[model samples]
Target: MRYIIVTGTSRGLGEAIATQLLEKGTKLISISRKPNEQLIEKAKYLTIPFDFYSFDLQEIHQIESFMEKIFSNIDVTNVSSIHLINNAGMLAPMKPLERSESEQLIANVHVNLVAPMLLSSAFMKHTKGWNIDKRIINISSGAGQKPYFGWGAYCTTKAGINMLTKCIALEETDKEYPVKVISFAPGVVDTNMQAEIRQTPKEDFIQVERFLTLKENDHLLSPDYVAKAVIELLETNHFDQGGIIRIDEQ
Candidate 1:
């Protein structure tokens, strides 16, 4: 059976992804700040509560231990493949860099960039020597490739993850038991994040109208739509040769 671990499954795109995976008979371990009642009802899902905002994920040893605990219950021999989907992220404190608070910036970095790095490392270390095919999908964003006003922290962290994906992909390619890694950009989806963007003051988020327009025009992709695309991509050999990929481009 395919075993998949997904972060940020409490809501939004992560929730949709987890739901679809469970429906397909994939065993899932969902990590989030709060338990998702819908996912918890699934027999194959194992919910692990982890508050990224409260925890110091920069502590690599703790991340390793956390992953170890999660993997301890599984018999690696029974699994055909293992997948890690780092889907948790935040876009907050949207303001110019000069106005952004240091603490908020650091927190954003930890959740968006540092946690994924640690989790990927722990996954690789723990799954070493296993013959199963391993894959890692990092939910990235278009903001990473292009700068947006008042999105300094968000853009920077996204950019960092993209580079992190590239670096890990390069390293894993040479491994005897390789892990395919892809930084997937899911185009603007109609989610809580978009709602937050739309509500932001024009002074803080100059492009708020753009998001509002998308919502008004019903142009935003549904979370489930993006989730389905992501799952299909994961099941295919298309992303085996990995790099930065955007769902919209597919």
Candidate 2:
């Protein structure tokens, strides 16, 4: 049985991914702020609630606890038998450079960059040289690939994640491990995150109207679409090199 771990399972893209994985007969360990009652009923899985929002990974103590708990819950008997999906993230309260909030930046960096990196490291440490097929799929963004002004902190954290993925993959290759590390952009998904983005002030967002238009015009990809695509990549052995994959490309 495939043991897959996914974060941000309270809703949106994360929940969708978990559902798809469950449907494919993958045993799941889901992490999120809260449980999705409907989704939990739809699939059999395990849930871990971590307050990444409030506790934040910026603090050293919380991270120590978080890392300890992860290893405690996950048993590493056979190597690379698990799939770790770093899907938890947030993009909210968009504002121009001068008006940006420090708390937001801190929170974004904690959730988007620090937590995923630490979690990946912990997983690797526990399962090193197990001689099994495994994967670390970091859910990233197009904003991370390029740029967007008002999304300063969000973009910064995402860009950090992209570079982190490359560095982690390189390290794995240097050590001669077969664990696949993929950094993927799942496209403009219609989720609570999008709704939060839409709430950004008009003058602050460069393409504010365009973003809203896309949402209203039904141009946004459903969370399920991206979720299924991620599952497909995880199931298939196509991404052995740990290259970046986008939703449209998948």
User: Which candidate has the top score in TM-score?
Assistant: 1
TM-score of each: 0.92, 0.88
Report the alpha-carbon TM-score of model 1 versus the true structure: 0.92
Please, what are the lDDT tens digits per residue for candidate 2 over residues 45-66? 4342222222344453466567
lDDT of 1 by residue, 10-79 (tens): 8899999987887444667778877787676653344432222223454535777788778887777678
- lDDT of every model, 2 decimals: 0.83, 0.76
Clashes of 1: 0
Task: Give all candidate RMSDs, comma-separated.
Answer: 3.2, 3.4
Root-mean-square deviation of Cα positions for candidate 1 versus the true structure, in angstroms: 3.2
